[model samples]
Target: MLYDRIGVGYAHGRRTDPRWLAPIVAALGDARTVLDVGAGTGSYEPLDRTVVAVEPSAEMIRQRPPGAAPVLRAVAEALPVRSGAVDAVLALLTVHHWPDWRLGLAELRRVAPLRVVLAYDTRRHADFWLVREYVPEIARLELSRPSAEQIAEELGADEVVPLPVPWDFADGVFPAHWRRPRAYLDERVRRSCSALAQAPPAAVERGMARLRADLDSGRWEREHADLLAAPEWDAGFRLLVSRR
Candidate 1:
């Protein structure tokens, strides 16, 4: 419920970047009827597909565009539709938020007539730049979020298509921010992440100060120069496309 209110203007700040989208859209692959589970403000949906969104957050639901897919107010643990109804199920960056992960996965298994697509960062990768130094509080906050391997099991996914994507300020929401330190310093971008949302404000303040000093002293650049150009880091962001 708390994440429902994450940042006042996310359509832009946390807008979906195309680098990740190209592959995600590919994974969704020709499914005419798609179910976007935990669809946040209808961010990653493909405009061409017929999408039915299920989200429990009132705040997030209201942000969906007027012409965007139809939305249903429901928790992931229990879906309103009958089994094997849709061509695919798509869940992105959201399994960690589920109160009952297995229950939600069970529902996912029950639905989706043929295939399912999912994206979530691995908790182990939370050690990326800001998460480890400027946002230690966020690291601790994310510890409870389930791992990628766990999600693979829950989806009963025959295979999870592997796509390693990273995010820098130049890119979208991703861990490659490990490469671009400046973006994490931005208030709007930081607001999109859950760990930052859960951290104590004072702790975040202190962390940011240290991060600022590192940037000012040229330490950050010297340390991660190569990363700045490196296209991707394995931040545990995995995509699972399942077939029924």
Candidate 2:
């Protein structure tokens, strides 16, 4: 499915979570040159580095910060940079949208000198209240996105470090809001989410209604009260710091 208006609102909701940022940043491993593939609105591009970004979306490119990389209107499968020009390559929450997976991975491998960092959610955790009760279609949408293991192997890494980062919606961010459950009810927050942001009107209505009912009936609390006190959830957001 094509990206919807969420691309416009993405900067608001899909922020650069610091916990997630640490791993992606550290994965670059002292690299000075970087390429942000599918750099949506320059949300996660790092400063103080020689960086370039590739994106085909015009609106997204327009949203780039004043100092962000000189974005080229290019697809990930076909990059404009010469081989080995960048020391690091990063793609956040975007690989899933690529129509061709292997070609994109091949492109990254050809250009990146050392590291390729990524953050993705592939597992459709039906157990997640947001997924289970509210928007199960997202789980189905994720099936098109390649798995992290596949990405690791594509980058030719013999070892992949899978770090578990959990977000509790109640923490007021990340995993914190999940424990609160009410965050998902907000239309603004939902608009920030690409999955629901792209959903059909009927599907969004149905999903939100179910989620509201669950929250009101205390079913959400009863089922996940134990998690409410807990700090975070293993949301399948991971860092794949692939090294040559």
> Considering every candidate listed, which one attains the maximal TM-score?
1
lDDT score at residue 63, model 1, on the 0-100 scale: 73
RMSD of 1: 2.1
Alpha-carbon deviation at 241 in model 2, angstroms:
2.0
The number of the candidate with the highest lDDT is 1
Residue 14 in model 1: shift from native, Å?
A: 1.9
Clashes, model 1: 2
* Tens digit of per-residue lDDT, candidate 1, span 113-187: 554555555565567777676767676657778877888876767767666665443434645466667766787
User: Residue 195 in model 2: shift from native, Å?
Assistant: 1.9
What lDDT score is found at residue 108 in candidate 2?
84
lDDT per residue, candidate 2, 1-244, as tens digits? 2443446655566655566566667778799989999987776677778888888887677767787788888899999989988888887767767889778878888898665556445663434567666666666766666877677667675445554445432112222366666786777677666666766768778987887898889887888878767655666655666666
Model 1, stretches more than 4 Å misplaced? 166-176
Error of 2 at 124 (Å): 4.1
Give lDDT per model, in order.
0.74, 0.69
